[model samples]
Target: MSYAANFERMGRGFDLAHAIAEADRCLLCHDAPCSKGCPAETDPGAFIRKLRFKNITGAIRTIKTNNILGGACGVLCPTPRLCEKECSARFQSLARPQGADRPIQIGKIQRFLIEHSWEQGSEVFDKPEPRPAKIAVVGSGPAGLSCAAELARDGYQVTVFEARPEPGGVLRYGVVSYRFDLQFLRREMEDIQALGVNFQCNSAIQGKESAERLLKNGYGAVFLAPGLWAAATLKPTPEDIEGLFSSVVYLAALRDGRLAEMARRIQGRTVAVIGGGSVAMDCIESAVKLGARDVYLIYRRSYRQMPAEPDERIEAQEAGVHFLLLNQPVDYVTTDHNRLQGVKLVRTRLGEPDDSGRRRPEPIAGSTWVLEADVVIEAIGNRAPEESPEWYPHVKVNGQKLIQADPASGKTSAAGIFAGGDIVRGPALVVQAVQDGKVAARAIKAYLDQ
Candidate 1:
C-alpha cells in the first residue's frame, strides 16, 4: 500500500446527526465539571448545551472565543485525561451495570462545529481596530498563535515571528499526518490571519535581547512561546552513524514529503525506535506504514510504564509494531562505512519509582544481546529548554530547563515579558499550550493596559 493509504486516519469525526446525539447525552449540570476540568477553559458543557439546542454558531463562537485552535485541539487533546475523565455522565454511569458508561464525545462535537463554521464562512471574531500598542510573539506554535489571536481580537497589532518558513510550530512539523492533515492546519492559520494577526515566517528571535529588543523597537509587549525543538538521546550515545536519526529529524522527514523516497529505500528492512513517549509512538507507526519488514519499539520499561498515553500505546500495538519491552539499549554497532548495523541491549527489571513516578528500569548485568537493524530512531524525549533570551536575564527556569512562570498567569520575573508552552511546562498537550497562550494573552493585555 502507498504510504498515505497505509497511514489513513484510523479515527473519524462525528457527523451532524452523531454530534447532536452526543451533545444530547450531556448531563448539563449547573456546575459543569467538564468545563472546570478543561485547561483552556473552553467550557465544553456550555458548548454542548448550545449544540443540544441546535445553536451551532453559538457553539462555534464559544470555542473560538476561548481557543484559537479549537479544531486542532478537538483532534489532538487527550480528552480521556482531561474533560472526559471528569465527565459527569461517565461518573454517574458507575451506578449502572458494566458496558453502560461512556462520556459525551465533546472532542468530536467540537471538531464537527469547527468544520461546519468553515463551510458557512462564519466570522469567529470581528476584525478589531488596531490599537496604539503592538505585540510581538516569538515562535508561531500553538501557544504563540493563541496568544497572537487573542491579542489581535482585542485590537492589538499582533505579529508572530517564526524561524521556520511555515507557522504552526510542532503542529505543522512534529504532529503525525494520520491524525492531523496540513489542509486543516492551513485553514486554522488562515482563520488566525483573518483576525488581523500577521505572521512573519523565517524571522527568528535571537537569544540576545529577545524580548527587550522587541519592546524597545516598535512592539509594546512581548510574549515568548518558543517550543522545545531539540530532540534528546541517551546520555552516552554511540558515535554519529548514517542510519540513525533523532525523533525530530525522523518526524520532520515524514511531513516534508521526503519520507516516501526514504521509505522506498528502506523497504523490507528492519527499523528500531527507542523511547516510550508519544513521538516514539509516531515513529513506530510511520515506520510500520512505511513498509518496514520489521518495526520494533525498544522501550526500557514495561508497557504499563510507557510515558505515552495508554490509548496511544494500544494504537501502536494495533499498527503491528513489535514491542521489545524491558530492554535497554546499551550501544549500537556500525558497519565499516559507519552505517548502523545493529543495536546492543541489556535486559531491564523494574526497580523503585523514579522522579516521574514510574518504576525505573534497571539494566541487568551479563545479559547484553544484539538485535540487527538497518535504521535506528531515537525518540527518548527533549533536551533542556533552548537557551534563554538575553532580554529576560531575570527569568528563572527549573532544573528541567522549563521556564518558571506563574501557573495562574504566564507571568515571568521580567516585567512586560510573558512566557508559556513547552518552554514553560515542557513537552505537553496542545490544549495545555493553548491554555498557556490564553493565560498569557490575558496577563499581557493587563500589563499593556497598565
Candidate 2:
C-alpha cells in the first residue's frame, strides 16, 4: 500500500447539511451534560445550539474562546469516552448498544463550524489591548499554545519557547500526518500567532539558573509545559541492540519526512511493535503501510485492556496488522552479528489488577517461544522529563516521576512558576492538556493581578 492511501484522514468532518442535521439532533439540554463532559470546557451544547440556529460565527467563537485548540481537539479527542457519551440525545438518536455512535457527533460538527468560519474568512476574535506583563511559556505543544493564547487574550505579552528547531512539539513531529495533517496544525498555529503569542524556536531552557534568569529579565511568570518526548525503552538482555526503535522516534521519522528511507529498509521485512497504546497501533499499522511483509502488535494483555482509542484498534485490524496477545517478550533473538532476528517470548495469563486498574499479565512458566522479526518498535509508553528537578529544584514530582502541581490551579511549589500538560499529567489527551493550560493561565493571571 502506498503511504498516500494511508495518509488519508479518517474523515473530513461534516458537510454543511450534515453538520446542521447533527446539530439539530442536539436536545438543547438546559443543564448541558455534553458541555460538562468536555475536558477543555468547550461548551459543545452552546456551540451546537448556536450552529443549529445558523449562527456560525457564534458557534466558532464559543469553541475557540473556551478552548484554543478546539480544531485539533475536534478531530483527535476520544469523544466515545468523553463529551459525545454524555450527550442527552444519544439514547434517542443512537439506537446502538455500548457506545456505537449513538451520540450526535458533536466533535465532527464542531470541526465543520470552525473550518467553515475559517473558509469564509470571517474575523472571529477581537484583538486585546496590550498589557506590560510578559509571560514565558516553555514548550509549544497544545498546553503551552493554549496558555499563550489565553494570556494574550488577557492582554499579557506571551512568548512561547520551543527546544526543537520548530514549534508545535508533539503535534509537529510526534503524530503521523495521516491522522493530523501538518497543514491543519500550521493554520491553528497561525491563529495563535494572530493572538500576539510569539514563538521562539530552538530556545532550550537548560537549567534552574536559566529559568530564574528569565524572571530576573522582567518576565513576570514562567509556565513549563515541555511535553513527554522521552520514550521508555525496553531493556534488551545485555544492552541495546540494532534494529530496535522506540515508537516516539519511529513516528517522528515519518512526520519529519524520513519515512521514505525507513520504508526502503522495512519493505518486505517482518516488523513487531510492543504495547497496547495508540502509538503501538500507529507503529504496527504504519509498518504495514510501509510495505512490511508481516506486521505484528505484541500486547501482554487482552484487546479489552488496550489503552488505545477504539478507532485505532479497528484501523489496525482493517490494515491487516496481526495481534499477538497473551504474550510477553523476554529478550531479543539476535544473530551472531547482533542484528535483531526475532523475539523470544513467553505466554501470559491474567492475574490480578495492577495500578492502572487493568488485570495484570503474569508470565506462564515453561511457556516460551520465539517470534520471527527483523525489526522491533517499542511503544510501551513515555516518561516525564527526568531532569525536571535539576531544571527547577523547587518543583515537586510524584511517584510516577510526573511533576506535581495543584490540580485546579496548576501552581507548583516554586513561586512565580507553574506547570501543566504531559509534564504534569503524564501522557494524556490533547483536550486534557488544553484544560491544564487554560487553568494555569487563569491562575497565572490571578497571581499577576495580585
lDDT of every predicted structure (CA atoms): 0.86, 0.86
Q: So what's the TM-score on candidate 2?
A: 0.95
Off by over 4 Å in 1: 7-11, 235-239, 384-392
**lDDT per residue, candidate 1, 1-450, as tens digits?**
577765544356888999998988888889998998888999999899999999899999999998989999899888988898888898766799986978888888889999889889998777687787889998999999999989989889898989888999888888877888887898889999888888999998877676667877888778888888877766454437878888888888777777676687567999999999888998888888788899999999998888899988999889888899999998888888888898999999999999989888999989999999999999988754456545466677777777789977898887777899998888888999998998999998888888
In terms of lDDT, the poorest run of 10 residues in model 1 is 383-392
Candidates in order, TM-scores: namely 0.95, 0.95
**Clash count of each predicted structure:** 0, 0
User: Which one wins on lDDT?
Assistant: 2
Residue clash pairs of candidate 1: none
Candidate 2, run of 10 with poorest lDDT = 93-102
